[model samples]
Target chain A: MAVYTEVPDDELAAFVKAYDIGEVVSFKGIAEGVENSNYLLATTKARFILTLYEKRVNRDDLPFFLGLLEHLSAKGLTCPQPVAGRDGEALRMLCGRPAALVTFLDGVSVRRPTARHCAELGRALAELHETGKGFALRRPNALSVSGWRPMAEAAKGRSQAVSPELDAIVAAELDHLEATFARLDLPKGVIHADLFPNNVFFLGDRLSGLIDFYFACDDAFAYDVAICLNAWCFEPDQSFNVTKGRALLSAYHATRPLEPDEVAALPTLARGAAIRFLLTRLVDWLDTPAGALVKKLDPLEYLKKLRFHQQANDATAFGWRP
Target chain B: MAVYTEVPDDELAAFVKAYDIGEVVSFKGIAEGVENSNYLLATTKARFILTLYEKRVNRDDLPFFLGLLEHLSAKGLTCPQPVAGRDGEALRMLCGRPAALVTFLDGVSVRRPTARHCAELGRALAELHETGKGFALRRPNALSVSGWRPMAEAAKGRSQAVSPELDAIVAAELDHLEATFARLDLPKGVIHADLFPNNVFFLGDRLSGLIDFYFACDDAFAYDVAICLNAWCFEPDQSFNVTKGRALLSAYHATRPLEPDEVAALPTLARGAAIRFLLTRLVDWLDTPAGALVKKLDPLEYLKKLRFHQQANDATAFGWRP
Candidate 1:
């Protein structure tokens, strides 16, 4: 729930003049994305989203994010297409921040996603990966296996404050994942590194759109699947629901068949996914200044998820028997 | 920028089932109002605003606020009409908070309002006061003249933290306003006590709608005018712009002719209005828990406005003549 910068009327009018979209009808700050300021912008022609990139987003990586959306939408994906100005530039400046206008996708994010929603999301995820094949830009996933150690070390001693045994569990998991990830040869491609349910929208029971491509990068496709498993298949009790896991994996497999090695690597990738979130969240939980605008998600939630992943011996444990 | 309560999907689906409005298409938390969790709800029929009243609003006062909106809309004022459910109830409990669905009003709020906008707002405000006459439900202005002292007392000694002489200015203004308000007899009616520019919507220089009636109450109509004058007729540098003041007053007077007494009391009411905000803002500044979600407005801004009002001797000083 943030609108850190207020856009003045004159400045907005001037900014809209650069676009081919008709006169601005209405604009409102949307409390959806946490990483940037998002506004539901309506014009005489159509509704769009106006995003002002905040400090958390690296300015250099914006073209990759914007370009990926353009590339995906062009490949028949239901995503926000970056609307270019009359000069054909999608990115511009507004309120002294990097800004862009994208066509609005019509759907609501499902809060408690069912197996059916997970299935639809799985199909969409596979479509995103397949569609992303043609995109030329490459950004390595910063939160991948290589990134975990530094984050875990930063939160190493302090993680016990969250829970007495958290530090030891995280340390053991880090060692296991680091050793396993270094030796794996897996199918790699563009992946929506943070394809959580909140970033996927549903119109009725159908997946209408996928959004918030900020965390997207070039990474193992199985890693993206693992992220979805952690995000979508878990219940309130932190127990993994195998039925939903099977639904997500089978739907994803139907779209793009996983290789034998990729299937075998699922459990390890899922463990890495859990630790990736757990370590980052743990660091954020400790580092966030008290009373900051953003709410720090509970790191212990991912700790519980990591514990579940630790027990899984094979891909069959995740309902994938490839 | 507030969406305090997360309305789960199952609960929202069940809640919307009671409404005659079409099936919900999209729901996004809007970063707009501070006092409530607002969502821009789109259905198959049309867009609507879903407001979940937060703790700042008194539960007992819900009917008055919702009723006033209904009453004003029925009287032909362009404002958000509270949408009644199939059971003919506009108010219901959702996510354990008093909630309501109101017809979405179009148009954007101008950050910097022009005199033309001020004139339109003036006419809309007069229309609101006239329409509100038919509203039977009455809520007293708790932030009016009498409410200032307790708040002033709470922030009295601590006021100097905002400004060096704020305590002295507030003390002097309270005594003056207390004495002046006791001796006044003016026309009283329903007044939108917090008619800031953000609460008024404009579409291409035309006033499209008025909103946020939480502070609407039974008070001297001129006091509402004074609040607007304090809100709208001031420049960024804190100097009063008499051209905008004249435009606002004359337009308002054209719609609802202010009685000689109401006109004569304008300067004093404006002074009291400044102090009213100053005292409340000062209290909020002092009492707000550190790191709270809402941003505490600067009390010194009102202190500056209070100083401007202290020198005005008559209605003519506010660009009005009895």
Candidate 2:
């Protein structure tokens, strides 16, 4: 299930040599993801996560992914900075694939976070989004309408579980979104497309660091907030816990009060986001390889999310009341 | 991005030989999904969708996927019926994969479904769950708690552009999700796993057909209804559109009112649905291949939906006051 290439110890050692930190004393592959292979490398002076270039990752986009990490880290964001290689570069070739080593963050991710933690995450997400401005690169939202339908096509005809009504709803929602959000004056900037609960790490009630920059790209700032609202505030059963939802949103608002335009466009953004997940999950569901340790996620989950977003009109539920 | 194999004309013809349907004069690939390869097959007697099996589908589970189609068709559920091949089998080898032919449905998905449509679809979904009993096959929830951490691990250690607070929130949420709802009374039954908006087609405010059944499997029935609530209700934005939510849930309740046991589990089911989406979208965000038309959806949208379900502790939002 390791999607990406595994970073080599020797290569990571070479990158560590380039850093202003310490000597590489240890390194090992952490076989976990379906994207990039990672190794926890400990140097004489510091710890780092050595990443191997996985097939799914675009080598060309390494600078964007790694550089953004450095940029955000330098801007006082509590993120792991990608270390420059021997060529005085963050991007480098390793094991015949693009690879890099990042500063190892402290503390394990909280397996159980409270409402206070949710609120803190909300505010922190706002801060990171605020810092993502003028991030030196411009990329369109990768999961926009133009990007969704095609994926849905890949998994078509395999599963009869997806009601055609759902497909129609997606098509119709796409059109509505195009018309509805086409005119919004929402501020545009870099946003984290995947702000799920596990992508973050906390040290007690305080946040230690944020990991996984693979989905960072130019898009709406509010979208990032919405993602956070969706990720951090849910109850155990996956329902929207208003107490946590409000706390998270309120924290986010306090840090970077949403612009009226961004606030207004939330419903549509929510739908767009929902459709995006539904399609990806659907594709995954239909294409899970045999003997793959990876579990196929239910596409219906996001379908429901999109359906709810479709019905969403009260800004209050989002805890961003006018 | 076609995830599966293409069904050949000869193969389509072979598969339809035993069915009561007419000749398959033509079959054209409907290049849309990333899960399965779908072809619009037309014959002198009827039009149908010829699906070629791909990796995500298990050959052993073909009976469930194919049989459910036939079963629903028998019950007058607006679904595509599986056509047997010359060998007297609904599933046959074609294009080096398992393939089947289904009667193509009539009517387009509604762009702007009326409240009645929402209610009707909800009721239909409930009825489908009711009828789903004794469905001869069962599969556990594919995107349950056991699936979350692995997905998170996939995206971990990859430079995130998130703030410390955001990281903490994610860690905390993961913990909470793992601790709670990790185990619950799962009223197992056949439930459609991907009931998105576009999967249903409507003709004049009535649900003409419910297409796509590849993801139908065993799980909590209320979770299915919760999925409907999330999908049928909600607007494009993240706001809760109570009216539509009400109509959809009410209509569903009218046909197959939720059991108190089901209602008790609604909150958890909603959360499960939300997390199911959050994880898949997160994985996609981290792993989409280059040149793959698939887009990574925002994980937060599900996070928001989860939040709403968390808030919906009572049956009011679900339109089930009883």
Candidate 3:
């Protein structure tokens, strides 16, 4: 739940006047994006999302993010389109922070995703990758292979407190993934690196929209698939849901068929995805004090998933028989 | 920023089935009301607020609160009306907590309210009090003068930690208020005891709606005005803005004239109002641990307001000639 900055009424009214949208009807601080402050802005014309970028998001990267959304929306993906002001600029300053208004999409995010939802997500992921071709901007994934070791080193001392075996397991996995992960030649494009279930919205069984493109960057399309497989195929008990994995992969394959090289790299990339989240969560858990408002997520949850990926060396183990 | 309960998609869909409003098009948890979990639920018909009552609000008082809004709306006051489900029941269970849906009002709450806004708020407040008449159900004001002593006692030990002169000031003021607070005969009706600037919404100096009725109860209407004077008439520096006070009072009087006794009792009521907020804030300040997510308000701010009201012994001090 994030509403880091409070936008005053007079400032907001003046800010909205820059755009051609009608006078503000209703505005509310919404608990949406975690990295910035978001307000559900309703005007006489339409409803939109007004986001104030906080310190977590780099100001220089705003153009890339907004441009990608525009590019994807033009390419027929259901995503937020940045609404430019009368001055032809979407990014401006409001409340001493960079802000932008985007068209609001209508859909409710599913909490417990079914196999059908997974299939929809898979097809949507493929569509996003295919549509992302020829975008001028390029942002390398910051939390990729090069970012893992530094985070693991930072959380090394306190990882034992989270779990007795966490330090050993992370160290061993880091060595293995660094040598093998993402080594194969595969398709590269703009991948939504963090396509978790909460980021995907659904209306009944149909996928309605995908949101929170903050973590998107240029990475292997197959790596994005691996991230989704790690994120969507795990049950509450840390057991692998092979049916969901098969549905997700087959749907993606039907949209854009995966090469054999990409298929063989799934387990290693999946393990790398697990490490990426585990290290970040480990650092957060170590830094957050007890009784803090933001609940600290257990890093060991990903460790359990990592253990399964370590044993599954082939695509068949994930129910993806290409 | 309260979103305590996580209502799953299946539960929310099932819950909305009982209502005839339409299928949910979008749902986002909103950072509104402090006491309950509020979600901005947009459906095919129109937007509505889904409130899941948290533990702070008593379960037994739900009907009285909802009934008061119904009565006020029927009397033509702009407020959220409770939306009944198919069975004609407004309140139901969702995610193991008592919940209700209310029609959404379109307005923006002001951060720094001008004198004009205060005048508009005064008229709307008077309208609320007048409309509150003839309501069958009744609920007592729990945070009235009777509730002050216990709270002050709880914060007495930590009072010195907050300020060097805090304990003595509170003790003296409590004794004085115990004798004169709410003793005079005044017009009694349902009062919005927490008519702070944020609780009232506006669109270009016109009052669009009033909200957060959890604090509404049967009490002296003049006392409610005193709460507003304390809440709205003070500048950020804690100085009383007599101009704003005059605007608020005169506008309210124009809507529903105040009796002579009510005018005479304004000073004591305003002083008592200051103490009421001062004690509650003091208790919250002492109880909240450092580094908690919810920001703790400074009790000394209200102390400054109380000091100003202490010297203001007559209604003329508030710029009301009557």
Q: Provide the lowest-lDDT 10-residue window in model 2 chain B.
A: B158-167
Worst 10 residues of 2 chain A by lDDT: A1-10
What C-alpha root-mean-square deviation, in Å, does candidate 1 show against the real structure?
Answer: 1.3
Better of 2 and 3 by lDDT: 3
Error of 1 at B244 (Å): 0.4
lDDT of 3 by residue, A1-322 (tens): 6688889899999999999999999999888877899999999999999999999899989999999999999888999999999999989999999999999998988877889999999999999999999899999899998899899889877777889888788888888877888465678999999999889988879999999999999999999999999889989999999999999999999998999988989998889999999888899889988887675778889989999999996999998976
Q: lDDT per residue, candidate 1, B1-322, as tens digits?
A: 6778888667888999999899888888888787899998889999999999999999999999999999989989999999999999999999989999999988888877888988998898888888888689889889887788888778777777777887776777788888997578888889989999889888889998998888888998989999999999998888998878988999999999989888888889988888888777778888887876677888778777877887888877777744
Chain B, model 3, TM-score against the native? 0.98
TM-score of each: 0.98, 0.48, 0.98
How would you class the docking of model 2? incorrect
Which portions of model 3 show Cα errors greater than 4 Å?
A: none
Clash totals for all models, in order? 0, 102, 0
Each prediction's whole-model lDDT (CA): 0.88, 0.68, 0.90
For model 1, how many clashes?
A: 0
* Candidate 2 residue spans exceeding 4 A from truth: A1-20, A31-33, A111-113, A162-165, B1-322
Give the lDDT of residue A33 in candidate 1: 87
